[model samples]
Target: MGYQAFYCCYKTDEVVSPEEACEMDLNIAGDRILELLQGDDDFFGLIDEHDTTLQFIRNGDLIWMEIPIPDQKGSFGKHIPIDEVGPLIAGLPSRIDLNDFSEMRFQSW
Candidate 1:
């Protein structure tokens, strides 16, 4: 299954579950974050997937990511922490001019 990411304005103490937050149309927010971090046209390619982790490659750099999946209440299946994934991506050699990805929509969760 494909997944999306999102940035939320709610407080950390708000107690909202990841599944609920994701359902709130946060893909736009996630996409915006990606745009700011990478660029308007940068493409993120999916590389790996596990029960709780996903890996993506952009410009040949690996990006590790974790998502918290709520228990059966929704599609949430597992929990992966970004801290575990970020470093893996940071260690890769940086490259330039990724695939032509203009006008691509960012995924949100």
Candidate 2:
């Protein structure tokens, strides 16, 4: 499979189920995360580990996560533009299906 990257948000308590988590409006939460990641160490540090197939960041009542898809036939992953993140996030559906965590794919190649 090709490389894919995902960005999502959910409650920090981990009590919320996938159904509830999907109901949290990822569009708004994603925007908050993007905004926070800008020139803010505290918000940036929410995500743990720089090197991994999966990484997560927690801030306040929200948690942000990323999953990178690697190129099966090659050693490198696809490239994604940084500028497209905001619009893609803002355009997310009101309800997201995070059960399998496959619905939100902002970048893949």
Candidate 3:
């Protein structure tokens, strides 16, 4: 059990397919975030030890992310917003191609 959030990129309320919703680059960011959480035990030690899961799903302009934050004794979960996705990626020392992804739908949110 954890904080649940959904991000939709379309103007309509209709559910969209993963492929169609992915036109906004939400999938790319999700993959990168997972990779970061997995590849960096030193940086995200809590995530690695607690087995935190960050899932991303695109349905009709809606990007759903299920982040199951572990309920350890005194631990808490950090929610990453869609706008901050760019800053988070930029903060990384790795060479990731952050094209227009960051600028994709900042206004939508």
Candidate 4:
């Protein structure tokens, strides 16, 4: 079994999940994220079963991402150029997990 996650996109007007109504696949979710990033949507969120959250807030050409560290009191965040997320999107884990996103440069938020 794999870790389950939910794609919460307001721009898409729905949250994609692992069900007949909406299956949760990384590729599809990644595409939705890309769409949200490239479009006028201001927020994109992915939350895993463990309750760890990865959230993004888009502001103009920059995107601010926040990942709440498990077992910690604060969050780790980074401000990235919009184009910089494309590669990271391609390399996302089968499951959307904050730990899997540690390769990026992040600061305590």
TM-score of every candidate:
0.20, 0.29, 0.24, 0.59
lDDT of 3: 0.31
Worst 10 residues of 4 by lDDT: 16-25
Q: Return the lDDT, model 4, position 70.
A: 52
Q: Clashing residue pairs in candidate 1, if any? A: 4-108, 4-109, 5-108, 5-109, 66-80
Candidate 2, poorest ten consecutive residues by summed lDDT: 40-49
| Candidate 1 residue lDDT tens string, 58-100 | 2223322322234533221222232333443333222211222
Cα RMSDs, all models? 14.2, 11.6, 14.5, 4.5
lDDT of 2: 0.36
List the candidate numbers ranked by lDDT, top first. 4, 2, 3, 1
The number of clashing residue pairs in each candidate reads: 5, 4, 4, 0
- Candidate 3 has its poorest 10 consecutive residues by lDDT at 40-49
In angstroms, the error of model 3 at 73 is 18
**What alpha-carbon RMSD in Å does predicted model 3 have with respect to the real structure?**
14.5
Tens-digit lDDT string for candidate 2 (1-109): 2112333333332222222222224455446545544431222111112222332344333334444435432222222234444454556443322343554345544
Q: Kindly report which residue stretches of model 2 are placed more than 4 angstroms away from their true locations once superposed.
A: 1-23, 39-78, 93-109
What is candidate 4's local distance difference test score?
Answer: 0.60
lDDT of all predictions: 0.29, 0.36, 0.31, 0.60
lDDT of 4 by residue, 6-98 (tens): 444565665544331233455665666667665444566655555556667677788877786755656777788877665555566645665
